[model samples]
Target: MEVMKVLHMNGGRGVTGMGDSSYANYSLVQQKVITMTKPITENAITQLYYSTLPKNLVIADLGCSSGPNTLFVVSELIKVVDQLRRKSGHDQSPEYQVFLNDLPGNDFNTIFKSLPSFQKKMRNQLGAGAGPCFFTGVPGSFYGRLFPSKTLHFVHSSYSLQWLSKVPEMVESNKGNIYMAQTSPPSVLRAYHAQFQADFSMFLECRAEELVLGGRMVLTFLGRRSEDPSSKECCYIWELLAIVLNEMVSKGLIEEEKMDFFNIPHYTPSPSEVKSEVQKE
Candidate 1:
């Protein structure tokens, strides 16, 4: 799947669409990511490392955006493995092969530039016993296979699953809204849900093929607490953006018609929806 646009924090920092202009920073977002997934990630690492401390371990971060956060998950995983090794009575560290996957259009140059510094830091922090880390970029949509079968032991993805493989068909009819909104018609909601199901299922299937039998994947993304797809908790942020766009149209800064066809290719699945997908997959 392809992303028609690249939407990211302004200048690689704060939350999107906030007026703070408060210098770019991902601390807030990073905190949420860690809060939601750190425990699970830690547990998964413990289990994986103790279960079979493979001498050579392979990890991939799907939808790994380019920035400081790109290596955050990898760094944490490495540390966990190191600690687990000690607890498991192992003396030698496992060799690491990390693959960073994102769309082909991602800003890979920045990641490549940061690799030298990242490697140096890892070396210092993880020590000589920390086996060599070979980081490589694998550009592609994670909805399909990007690695050889059973090649990956752990996979981590954060702040990405909300994005569908592509925009749902007939979403152009979702006028006056850029994403799921209270005003969106039933058909629009169905289209979005269907697209999410298809995309997420493909993601699971592909990962299932790539991971070993006991491999683990830690994924975190936006989701609604309520079952309703258009619940305010999920769609309110887009609603706020729509309000801003309407104001822009009133000020003649953009065309009124432009808002009619603009829609974000994102879907916030409820817990049940996620459970269903996992069970089905």
Candidate 2:
């Protein structure tokens, strides 16, 4: 864990054109956010689910980008496993099978290269006496199942699920707009909202398929608590981006009318929405 923290001092897997995922590094900004609330969330996960992990636990982190933050989360699972084992009074601890998953376009190269060092750090921190822990990458969309049935004992993901598979197909120029552009003359917030719903629902279904019965998953994602359906809080981003694009048009730096309508392919589902989906799973 000491070594893991050391590695983290370095940042996030950068966003990819293919939407590449990189390893988490600690930017001053990122470290501040990490310190703000993750400890409480981690504690909750540990208290409730630590004892339930089976021996030889097959744990997987969905959307595990190659970054320092990923290490932090992975290390939590490792520590949790250790604590559980100590309580169970077993010298033979579960082997950790970590599956670092993300979109296919993810930088498998970075993950593969850095993973060796991560393993070495783990070995050094854990000691030769500690039970074996294995690391592997599963590259694919979290919107689909990337692992075998009932294989995962515990699952985790943070910050990635909010990303949709692609810009909504509806969002294109000269082609019928499947997505509402932030630049659309009147508005396309409704279209954006629809896409978020579709993507998030798909995410829930995919995860439900992969996790074991009674297994637990801890997820932290971008969201809001506002109850109004048409609140501007959600769409204000489009307004802001529109201001910038409008400037581009005024400067003649870009086409005045051709600004592809754009908005984040995201939505913060109500807590009730999340809980209801969990129940279905």
Model 1 pairs in collision: 13-24, 13-25, 14-25
lDDT by residue for model 1 over 98-124, one digit each (tens)? 999887766666677778888898889
Q: What TM-score fits each model?
A: 0.89, 0.75
Off by over 4 Å in 2: 1-53, 168-187, 229-238, 279-281
Error of 1 at 99 (Å): 0.5
lDDT of each: 0.82, 0.59
The best candidate in terms of TM-score: 1
What is candidate 2's lDDT per residue for 130-193, written digit by digit as tens?
Answer: 5677878776677766888778777777766655555544433522222233344333444445
Provide the RMSD of all predictions against the true structure, rounded to 1 decimal: 3.7, 7.4
lDDT comparing candidate 1 with the true structure: 0.82
Residue 251 error for model 2, in Å? 2.3
